[model samples]
Each structure stands twice: as C-alpha cells, then as structure tokens.
Target: MSLVRKFATVASGTLMSRILGFAREMLMAAALGTGPVAGAFYAAFQFPNTFRRLFAEGAFNSAFVPLFAKEIEANGIDGARRFSEEVFGVLFSVLTVLTILMELAMPLLVRTIIAPGFASDPQKYELTVALATIMFPYLMCMSLAAMMAGMLNSLRRYFAAAIAPVFLNVILIAVLGHAWYTGADSLEVGYAMAWGVMAAGVVQLAIVWIAARRAGISIGFRRPRMTPNVKRLLWLALPAAITGGITQINTLIGTAIASGQDKAVPALAQADRFYQLPLGVVGIAVAIVLLPELARALKAGNDGEAASLQNRSVEFVLFLTLPATAALLVISEPIVRVLYERGAFTSDDTVLVSSILAVFGLGLPAFVLIKAFTPGYFAREDTKTPMVFAAISVAINITIALTLFPRMGAPGIAVASVVAGWANALMLLVVLIRRGHWGHDAPLMRRIPRLVLSSALMGAALYGGAVWLSPWLAPPASLLAQTGSLALLCAAGALVYFVLAFATGGADAGMVRRNVRRGSAAPAGTEE
Candidate 1:
C-alpha cells in the first residue's frame, strides 16, 4: 500500500476514536464537572493510562512490531504466529501478576506518585486511591490488547486495532450517561465511569483479538516459558520500557506538581485530551503503521526504499500536523468551552484549561514529529538512542516544572512539557541527520516555507475570528452558551485552516488525489 492510503486508513480509524474520546470527555465534564470528584476521576484515569502508554503502546508495540515483521519476512506466517503466541503467553502472565500487585499497592502508589493534589485534602487523596484501585486492572487487559494490536499492524491489518480505542470512549460515555439518566449522585456516577474504564479495556482487547483471529493470527495462552525469542523480546522490551518510564516521568512530575494546585491536574488532563486528538490521530497512527514497514524494508536491505518511506512519512506528518497545531492554538478556548464547560465546569475552569491547551498546542508539532522520527531508530533496532533522548527530555521537563511551578502553576507545567517536546524532537532530528538516516529531501524542503505561510494565514484568520466572535461566543457562566460558543470557534478554525491549506501549496491537492488513486489500485497486504 502507498503511504498515503496506509496513513488514511489509520488516520480515519483514529479520527473515529478521537471523536468518541471527545464525547466521553464531554459526558465526564457534564457528569462530574471540574471539582474534587472530577480531579479524582482524572487522576485515577491517568494512573492506568500512564502504564498503558508505558507497556502497551510505547514499549510493547515498539519492541514487538519490528521483531514480528522480521519473523514474518524470514520464516513466513507460521513462524510469526509462533513468535506471537510465545510473547502473548509471557505478556499475559506478567501483566496478570503486575495488575494484582498494582491493585493491592494502589493506595501507596497514589500517595507517592499521584499525591500532590490530594495533600491539602485527605478525602480527595483517598478517593483517588479508591478509584485508581478500581481502574488499575485495565493495564492487564490493555497490555494484551497492545500485543494483539502489534500483531495486526505487522500483518497490515490497521483498521480494527486503530478503531478499538473508540470502544473505550463509547463504553465510558454509555456508563456515565446511564448513571446520569438514573439520577445517580455525581460521585456515584464518577465511580461508575472508573469501573467503565476496566470494561472498556476488556472490550478493546476482545475487538483486537477478533481482528487478530480474522487475520489468521490466533493467540492463546500456552504454558508460560521463556523461549529464546521470548527472552529476546523481553531484552528489547526492557530498554523500551525504561524509555517509556523516563518519558512518563515528566507526566508524573506534572501530575505531582499539578496536584498541589486546585483543579490544575484536571485542567492539564482536559487540555491533553484536545492535544492528543491530533497526536493520536496522525502522530501515533503513522508511527504504528510505518514502523513495521520500515523495519521490513531495512531488514531486506532496501535502504533506498526505507529512505523514501521515511521521507514520505515525514511529509505526511508535516502536511497534517502543521495545520492541526495552528488550529488548536487558535481555537483552544472554544474547543475547551464547547466540550468541557458544563455542569460543574465553570467559566473559570474553561479559561484555565484553554490556556494550558494553547501551551500544549505550541508543542503539538514537536510531539507529533517525535512520533514520526522515533520509529527510524526503533526500526533499526536501536532503542537506546531514543531512550537517551527521552532521558534528556525528561530532565528538561523536570527542570521547567520545578523552576516554573512556583510562579505559573499548571500552565507553567504545560509549557515545560512543550519545551521538553521540542527539545526531544530537535535531539532526534539531529541524531537522525548525524547518522545519515534522515536528511532534508528537496520536496520536504520546498514545502516548508509554504507550509509555514499557510499555517500563519490560518492562525491569523482564527485569531481574528476569535476576537470578533468573543462577545457572542465568550464562554458564559451558563453551560448552553459555553457549549455553543465553543462549537462555533472550532467550526470557524476548521474552515479557515482547510481553506488556507488548500489555497497555499501547504496541501497539494493533485498529489493527494493521485496517491489515493494509486492506493486504490494496490492490493491489500502489498507493502510498498
């Protein structure tokens, strides 16, 4: 498949997931608001999610896909199937044990790692621990899901795995909406949401499992044994896991610092939801789909093809991510207000969250680029290089967090994250260039100035629209006006960005149309 079609398939599924995620957050905002209950729920959600990134998405996928692809290329389908089964057995065993331990240790873990916000309020702290315990088991299910997802991506079955996350939001929204309709207390409804997280994990896992089966990759639990391949997988996974941990340390630091400020944690969380929309849809989807292809191309000694693929991935990411960053920065306020300003979510909360979203927006491209670039190293089986960069990024994040938290609070931490992201992206790019693995292709270089100009135009239009519409769409203290204004702002930004990107050379309509046409003619599973 052409890169564009691969990306489109992944991006379309991710867009569905992001939409559902938006709906889920909207329901959470309306159901719980930005109070202690909301804070507790967000904190609880972050606990499992942090590990989910560390294990399932970051570590496991990065380590698993390259190896699986190599096995498929070398020994064919049965060898790849055996490799997956072995990994699944070990992963399931380890994750089950880890989940039990995490659940049992939830209170202490929350006290140590997620304790900042709860220090002033003992009840909130305890509540977070309770909620975290209910949600911690999600890691086990999601870890298995990630393994399944890695297999699917290796097999080029991107649709189901990409779409599975939408189920998470769907389940959460259904649970919360049902509770609200039954007139449950806000706290009770929030707890129901927490439990719904676990249910979502089960559903995600099942969806991916079915996809895997359909792809002729059936995974089962055999007697857990550390075969040579299993050991090799673990060895690769260790550095990757540590890399994820180091990267997550920044988030932990932000959480620790944000915990001390009332509503800061949830504000950052809500802003992240918006930022992650583009990051997940474009950045993550590209990384997942590209890594295995890159790995196979490199392993087959197709350096030129690998280089071309890398260049296309960069172009694809830049083409989409540039405007997304601009739009988010432009429409941060309305996006937050429209989606989150409800029930207990006050106008003040909307302002605070939107400020953080803008800060996050500045780093959105950097974050997306990291996803685009890291696969270059991982596909080369060089995990440690990215780990080194991750360590530096973590240090940068920590320095900014400690230095700025006293004066700026949560927004400061958000800025720190953005700075860290840029630092990481630059470091990765520098290393890639130094190694001669990635360089500026003429096409990418030619597109840069026009892309910037287009983004600038979009930003200007969005800012002007925001200024003009502020009075009409200014977040009212009322939920209805807040929601309506937010929606208008987002619609305006989307219109402006799309028009500018099309008019400027930032988006090549002919090239995209040609690529899509070529992609349609290609058979499934035909790797370019």
Candidate 2:
C-alpha cells in the first residue's frame, strides 16, 4: 500500500469518527443549545478532554511511537512487547490513582481549575462537578487506550486505533438524541451525557485493547519496572507532556474566561466542533502517520527520505487544509446555521459561533502545519524544543485572550488562539530549519505558492457559490435544500481547487493515484 492509502486508512477512520462527532455535536446543540445546561456540560467535558487530547493526540504519541519503533527495530518484537507491558503497567497504575484522586477532589477542582465562574450558582457549580466526576475515570480508560493505540500505530495497524473514537461520538449521539426526543430536562440530559462519556471511554479502551491483542501485541499489566529505556521514554515524554499540558492549559484558560461571559462556553464549543472536523481528518491523521514514518526513516539513516516524507506530508496536508480554511472562512455562518439552527439553538447562537468559526478558520492551516511539522523534532527524540515553543505560544495566547476578551467577547478568544497557533507553527518550523532537521525541499518550495493560488481560487469560487445558494442555505425550508446548498458549495470549491492543482501541476493527480495505488505505505523501505 502507498503512504496515501495508509494515511487514507487512518484518515478514513478519522473521517467516520469526525462525521459522527459532527452528528453528536449537532444533536447536543439542538438538545441544549448555548444555554446554561450546555455551558455546564461543555465546561465539565473540557476538564478531561483537555487532558485526553494532551496524551492521546498530543505528547504521549509523540514520545511513545518513535521509541517503540526503535525498540522493535533494535531489539525485536519480544523486547518491544516487554517495553509496552511495563509502560502499560505504569500508565494503568498511575492513572488509577490519579482518577481516584480527581474523583475525590472533583468539586474543589471544578471550583478552582475547570470553571470557577460557576461558583456563583450553587446548582450550576454542583452540576458541573457531578458531571465532571462521572467522566473523570475516562482518564484511566483513555490513558491505557492511548498506549494501546501507540502500540498499534507502531505496528502500522492504524484502522482500529483511528476508528475507536467513533464509539464516543456514537454513545453521545445516541444518548443526546434520545434525550432530545423524549424531552428530557436539561439536568437529566446533562447527567445522561456525562455518564455516557465514561461508558464510551470503557468501550473505546476495549476496542483498541482488543485490536492490539488481535495483532499479537496484547499489553497486559506487568510490574511497573523502570528500566533504562523506560527512563528514556519518560524523559522524552516529560517535555512533550508539558508542551501538551501547556497548550491544554491555555485552552482551559480560554474556557474559564469564556465561561464568565453569558453562553460563551457552548458558543466556543459549537465553533470548535465545526473546525475540529477538518483538523481531525487532516491534521491529526498526518501527525499520527508522519511521526512514525519519519522516525523509521531517520533510524535507517535516510535523511533524504525523512526530509521528503516531511515535505510531502506538508504538501498533502496543506492541499486539504488551505481550501477547507477558505470554505470555513467564507461560509461559516451558513454552515453553522444549517447545521445547528434548529431546536433550542437560536439565531444569536449561530451568529456568535459562526464568527468564532470564521476566525478559527484563519488559524486552521497553522494548526495543521504545526501538527505536520512538530514531528520533525519529535522523530529525532527532541521534545524540549516544542515544549519551549509551546510555552511561548501559551504565554502569547493568555496575553492576547485576556486583552481581547474584554473587548471582543468569545470571538476574541478564538482569534487569540488562531494568532497563537500561527506563532507556534512559525516557531517550530524555524527551529526545525535551524537545527537542520527539516529543510524545505525544492518541490515543497515550488508547490506552496501554487497551492496558495489554487486555494485562493477555490475560496473565491466558494464565496460566489455561497452567495448563489443563500436562499436555500437555511431551514424553515427542507433539510434537503439546506444540505444540498452547503454540499454543492463544498463540492464546487473542492472541484475548483483540485482542477486548478492538476492543471497547474501543483499536485500530480496521476502521481497521487499511482503512489496511492502501489507506492510507499509506510515509506519505501521500512519494516512492516
């Protein structure tokens, strides 16, 4: 299989999860809208979710995969399995204790760290505490699940791990949709979703754990033995954890500040749901696949191959991101209106979330580029650099968000995050260049300008398409009409971008087809 197909396999799974996640969010929004119930739930969910993203999608994967790949290469599968068992043991034990502690401290933690703004309302504050406590053990399930996923990705078994997240969305959508249909009270619905989250966590862990077992990489609990390699893994993981932690903390800060404003919490969450669709399918997929591929390339002393992989990953990700960014920027309101304007989700909610989504679109490319580029350092076992850069980005985010929120409201928080995202990406790229890690290849350099041009053309086309489709863009009409309008605008934009890309030789469709057909799946010369 080719790299594209491997990425597609992972991406396809993610695409499904993302699609289901969109459904889940839409259901949740209609059920609760940007009301206090939605606010409390989002705030509570972010508590663990912020940390989950840190480990599952962010630092742990960066630290674990390369080291695991090296262990497999140097010491064979037996040694690698042993390493995984020890790590899993440690992870399970630590998270078990952590979950207990967090559960015990749920109220205090909610009052302090998660959302102090809720303190003014006894009922709201207590509900968030209860909601978060129900979901806290998700930390335990997901921590182990993340390790299992790392094991699977190291073995180039991407599908199950990539698709496991869909269970979460599935559970949530089922619960939320049922609650909505039954006209469950907001309080009843919130608790239902909270418990549903924890249930999904168990199922998510089971899915990946079973997949790893089927792949002959069952990570049973062993004694938590900290060998030299374990130490090395922890050392590498520490900085990456801090980096992921800092970034999540910045998000927490944004949420905390946003929570103070009326309805800002759910507004931001709604906007995040839309933007995360593209980010998940493109950025997350590239990062997960790129990290190990680059690691193996460097391990084999194929610097040229490593550089090429990085460049191609960047090009491929940008090819998707730029146009998506344009569409979101151009058609955010209509998209949000079409998706979430029913039930309790009001016109005011649409306006706020859409504006936030549009600003977030500006940073979308940078967010994905950071995901694509950070692997350059991570693949080389250097997490401290990203840690430093992440700290810088966090500081910038806090300052800008704090400064702007008083003036611009929830949208300002989104804009601050966008600005900080660009700053972080630029910094990482600069460092990668300075350290001689990832130099831009000639192809990358040549094609980027053209990619931008193609994306611009698509953006214009989408803008015109949206203008033409406005009357049919919103409901009080048929769902078919509204969905058809949005889908048509998106398809037209995609058509324009790809047509221009192939016409100008910006992206080689034939090459993509050939490569995706019979080309590098895990790179040209890596162990399977």
Candidate 3:
C-alpha cells in the first residue's frame, strides 16, 4: 500500500478516537466541570499518561521499530521473534516492579510530580494519591501494548494499532455515563474512571496481541536476561527515552504551575483535548508511517524516494495543519462555548479554556512539523541529536514558564509551550539541513507559502463568521441549534480554506482521490 493510504487508514481510525475523546470530555464537563474533583482526577491520571508517552509513544517506537524491521529484513522471522521475546520479558518485568514501587510511593509521586499545590487541601491531596495508585498499573499494560503496536506498524499492519484507542474511549465514556446515571459523586466517578482505564488497557493489549498472533508473530515472554540484542535495544532506547522524558517533563512543569489556581489544571486539560485532536491525527499518523518507510528506503540506498517521501509528508502536514490551526485559534471561543459550556461548566470557564486553546493553536503547526521531520533522524538511528534538542527545548520551556506563570497563569504556561515547540522544530530543521539529511523540494517550498497565506485568509473569515454566529453558538441556545451553527461556521471555513488551498497549489484532491481509488483495489490481508 502507498504511504498515503497508510496515513489515511491510521488517520481514519484516529478520527474516530478523537471524536470519542470529544464525547468523553464533553461528558466530563457536564459531570465534573472545572471543580476540584475534575482537577484532582486529571492531575492523578498524569502519572501513567506521562510514562506512557515517555516509554511507549516517544521512545519505544523510535528505538524498537527500526531495529525490529531490520531484524525481519536481515535475519528473518525467527530472529525477530527471539528478540521480541527477550524484550518482552525485560519490559514486562521492569514495568511490573515499577508499578509496584510507584503504587507504594503514590503519595510522594502525587506530592512532588503531579500537584504540590493540592497538598494544602488534605482531602484533595489524599484523593489524588489513591486514584494515582489505582491507575499506576495501567502504565505497565500500555507500555507492553505499545510494543505490540510498533510491531504491527513495522509489519505494515496499521488498522489494529490505530483502532485500539477507540475501545479505550468507548470504555471511559460508558463508565462516565454509568457514574452520571447512578448520581455518583465526583470522587466516585473518578474511582470508576480509574478502574476503567486499567480495564481498557487490558482490552487494548488483548486486541493487539490477537492481531499479532494472526500475523504470525506471537510474542511471549521468556526469562528476563540481558542478551546482546536486548542490551543494544536499551542502548539505543536511552537517548530516545531521555528525549521522551523531556517531553513529559515539560507537561509536568506546565501542570505544576497551572495547579496553583483553582480549575487551572482541568482548563488546560480541556484545551489539550482540542489541540491533541489535530496533533494525534496528523502528526502521529505521519510519524508512524514515515519511520519504517524511511528506514527501509535508507537501508535500500534509495535516498531519492526517502527525500520525496519526506517532502510530501511535510507538505501534507502543512496543508492539513494550517486550517485546523486557523479554526482552533479563530473560532476558539464559540467552539468551546458550544462544546463545553453546559451543566457545571460556565461561560467564564469557556473564556479561559478557549484562550488557552488559541495559545496552543499557535504551536500546532510546529508540533506537526516536528513530527514530520524527526523520522529522518530516527530512521538513521541517531536519537542523540533529538535528545539534545529536547533538553534545550525543556530549558526554554522552564525559563519562560517560570517567568510567565507569575503574571498570566495557565495561558502563560501555554504560551511558553508554544515558544518552546517552535524552538525545538527550528533547531531540528537546521540540524537536518546542516547534516545533509533534509532537501527542500520545489513543491514543499512552493506549497508552504501558499498554505500559510490560505490559512491567514481562512482565519480572517472565521473571525468574522464567528461574530455573526455567536448568538446561536452560545449559552441558552438549544443544543441542536448551537451544533448547527457551529457546523455552519466550520463548513464556511473549510470551504474557504480548501478553495484557496487548491487554487494556491497547497492541496491535491486529485492525487488523494487516485491514491484512495488504488488503495481500494488492494487486497485486504496482504501487507502490500
């Protein structure tokens, strides 16, 4: 299958998960709002979520997938199987011990890493510790699941891994609904949600494990041993792991700063849900496909194909990113009002959260671009450069966040993140160009200017459109009317952007259509 199709498959699945995520957040807003309960739950949940990103999302794929694919290509299935078993043993054992230790140290973890501000409130502080302890084992489940996902992606089996998160969202939404129906208190709902997270993790793991079994790559654990291959995997993974830690550390700092004020943490979490929709669908979709494809291309000494792939990936990301950025930034207020301002969530809350969302919008393109560009380095087995850049970006974030949080609060923390994201992206680009790894194709150079201009045009349109649509999009309006009004606004913005995008040569509907058509004709079961 073409990389475009792979992207489409992964993105389609991600779109479902993101939609379900919106649903889950909407329910939470109605049920918990920006209350102390919501704040405590979000704060507690960050422990496992942080490690999931650190080990599974960021480090594991970069270090494992390329090496796994190399093993398959070089020494065949048996070799890959042996390596997988060893890694599985070590990963499971380490995560098991870590989970147990963290569970015992949950109070310290909550006090130091998550929400030190809550320490003043004994009830909130203790609740956070308990919830975090319950959720800690999820890290173990998801870390192992992520390895399965990497394996499936390397084998060109994208659907199972991509769809796994939908089940997670499905489970959480159901649990939240049950809690609401039972008229459970916020704390009860949080405990249910915490247990539900662990349950979803197990289901997701089983889904991927079954998929792997069907694909003739059943991975089972052996005795944990430091084999040469496992040592090499760890060696390569260390820098990537540090890079991932830097990413999570930035989040931790932002949350810590935001935790100082009431509702700040949940407000930022709401903003995150919106921005993450685009980042997950576009940035993550590109990153997943680009890495293994680039690795294979480089290994085959096919730099031209690798360059072309990189160019189109960047162009595609820019084309998709610009409009999402425009919508999120321009109509952010109405979007938040329509989606979240109901039940316990207030107009004042909408204002603050929307402002934070807009701040995050500024960094969206940079985030996606960073994802698009990094595969070049990861594919070449050079994790150290990104680790260094990530360190520098964290320093920038900490300095700016510390300076701004005193003055501007949660939005200030968000602004720091945006600035740091751009710094990381620019530094990565400069290094790529310097090392002769990046070649700016004509289409990329041409389309970027057009994409930016078209987005600016769309943003202006949305600003005016939002004003005209505000009455129906705000509180006291019926849900149907508000939804319809928001949809109309989106349709207008999408129409304007796509027309300008096509006119300016930033998008090619024809090419994507052809790819889809060809993709439709391919056999479903084959890797190709």
* Candidate 2: tens digits of C-alpha lDDT, residues 1-528: 567777888889899998998898888888888988899999999989887877655657899999999988898888899988878777777777878888999999988889888888888888899899888888778877888888888888888899899899899988987887898998999999999999999999999889888877766678887878778888888788766555466678899888778899889888888888888899888888888888888999999888878877888888889888888888999999998998899998999999999999999998888888888988999899998998888889989999999999999999889888899999998888888887657766777888888888888888888888888997666888999888888887888999998787778865476345543444332223
Which digits, one per residue and each the tens of the lDDT, describe model 1 over residues 1-528? Answer: 667778878888899988888888887777777778888888888888888888888877788899998998788879999998888888888888898888888888887887655856888988899899999899898988998888888888888888888888888888977987899988898789889998999999999999888888877678789999999888788667656454356776798778887888888888888888888888888888779878977897988877877777777778778877888777787777767777778889899999999888899888888888888988988888888888888889989898998899899999899999899989989999999998567867877778777887878887887787776665344657656665676677667766776676666776476445442233255332
Stretches of candidate 2 exceeding 4 Å from the true structure: 244-247, 509-528
lDDT of 1: 0.81
Error of 1 at 114 (Å): 2.0
Give stretches of model 1 more than 4 Å off: 242-248, 475-499, 502-504, 509-528
For model 3, residues 49-133, the per-residue Cα lDDT tens digits are: 8888888878777889999989988987788888899999999999988888889888987887789989888999998888888
- Model 2's alpha-carbon lDDT is 0.85
Reference-based lDDT, residue 369, model 1: 86
Clashes of each: 2, 2, 1
Highest lDDT among the candidates is held by which one? 3
True-vs-predicted CA distance for residue 516, candidate 3, Å? 6.9
- Sort the predicted structures by TM-score, highest score first: 3, 2, 1
